[model samples]
Target: MNMVNTQVRLAARPVGLPGDGDWTVTEERLPALETGQVLVRTLYVSIDPAMRGWMRGTPSYLPPLGLGDVMRAWTIGMVEDSRNTLFAEGEIVTGMLGVQRYAVTDGRGVTKIDPAEGPVSAHLGVLGVPGLSAYIGMLDIGRPREGETVVVSAAAGAVGNVAGQLARIHGCRVIGVVGGQEKCRHVVEDLGFDAAVDRRTEDVAEALRRHAPQGVDVYFDNVGGEVLDAAVRSLARGGRVVLCGAVSQYNSENGVGGLPGYISLLINRARMEGFLVFDHADRYPEARARLREWVKEGSLKVVEDVVPGRVVDFPRLLLRQFDGGNTGKLLLRVED
Candidate 1:
């Protein structure tokens, strides 16, 4: 019997927020695996803010997913068959599995995941790039000290949630900037943030003043633009700004620009630095060990909002991340 694979591909470069017309879905027969490759049956698919950037034809840290190409995504899957010595049938793995029901990846590119350690979805989240981003940005770059205050935008998001909690672990007072009151409550009540500012209902800068009276010592920035401007204005002396993602500008037609406030950095003696998660690939194990330990100890929360159904739903599922429909790590459940 021949194996069948369903997939979603990029049909066109999106001009703005991608609509249904931007994608195409098809089913194809799986070909035999070649040497150094393994056939994977996808279980979970990650829908991230970065996907918006991938839909455009432009120069970036990584090349854009071309038109008619399988939509690129990090996925957790089980090995259906293997032609590589490193991978075996029935083993679970995670990597850039694309938006598909089945994928063949060279063993070199994939990472084996043990579900016994944590939820397999986590391999695409806290134990994955988003988690690693939070870890490296906080510990290596921001270097939150005990008794300092840390403020993060997109505080209920995947990276922001972890960043806030990790800052708190270092004995910093942590405040989160979220979109709504419910998300604000989640950040504070569920995630243990000292306070959460609802950007939709509250003045972010004023909220920062109330929550962080001493001014921010560390700013773990996620949404740039106005939020970044507000954060800069509220910074303490010698504050470190750990620049992660700029979801606010991902879908913009014009060039992305934030508040014109370079003078604030000079006045506050603040440092702003941007980083990609892959830069610390060599130290993933170090971060992974600590994150897993935190999860096991109930100190770190691993939240994944999973969208169940077929791979054809990928394009629609991806847009949800931008709309703030997801609370934590957004994932597409490709298989039962």
Candidate 2:
């Protein structure tokens, strides 16, 4: 088949937030699929805070993208053509398809998704990495008990919102710490969070005191820096803190900001741990089954903030993740 592929390749390592000079968008002729390979036409690409870390040249959980390489991203698309017998033409699939209009893979990381299970978008958000992150990190790590107080930072986001709701389902009192009044209202009203602390309008520490007088039993932290420090001060005895992501310091030229001290852990016998979604990849099937049940039963709600654009517009689109410019999981729709 003859076709042109549009893609954004990393052109430079960004010091802070990624910009235009950081990537080169070009159109090239699509290569023919060989044995065991499949061609995917990207429908949606997930835009995440974790992508910022993947861009830095410094050592991280995953290797950084090399210059002129296709920008890394998780995409949900249709199998346009396939030499792999496992996948059929027109089958919906999800994988690390990168920032491109089309991707060719050997089916190494690809997973077939059933539209009958849910909407295709659900594969990118709820049943995808974000939902898995919330499930394993919160349940396995946080270990919230009935009537315990659970607080989630960046609570209106894709992972954080699901983490909060999962805590509530386990019979815990959930408090969501979001940036604005609208997010606060939506988190509490629309998503069934017990309470929401507006970081932009209210003092987070004071709000925690009012909502969780006894203390925070579990903290699902998405943002570090001051918000983390404030949450630390409210920990109850034997509390657990799940360190999911640190969007607050992703762009800092200096070191990422962190807890003022671990005294809360020492004093309250508390524990704080960092969670990477990939670490629990083996259990994804188990988690996905539960997520599917909840979503189908209408107990779990997934939110997606989709922006309209193509590969050439991805650099500017990434900036939205850094500035709290979008709510829930942000995605760039490469095709209608």
lDDT: worst 10-residue window of model 1 = 255-264
Cα lDDT tens digits for candidate 2, 101-153: 99999999899888887689888888889999999989999999999999999
Query: Across residues 238-261, which tens digit of lDDT does each residue of candidate 1 receive?
Result: 988989989999999997885786
Off by over 4 Å in 1: none
TM-scores for candidates 1 onward, in order: 0.98, 0.97
lDDT of each: 0.89, 0.89
* Residue 63, model 1, lDDT: 89
User: Over 4 Å off in model 2, which ranges?
Assistant: none
Clashing pairs in 2: none
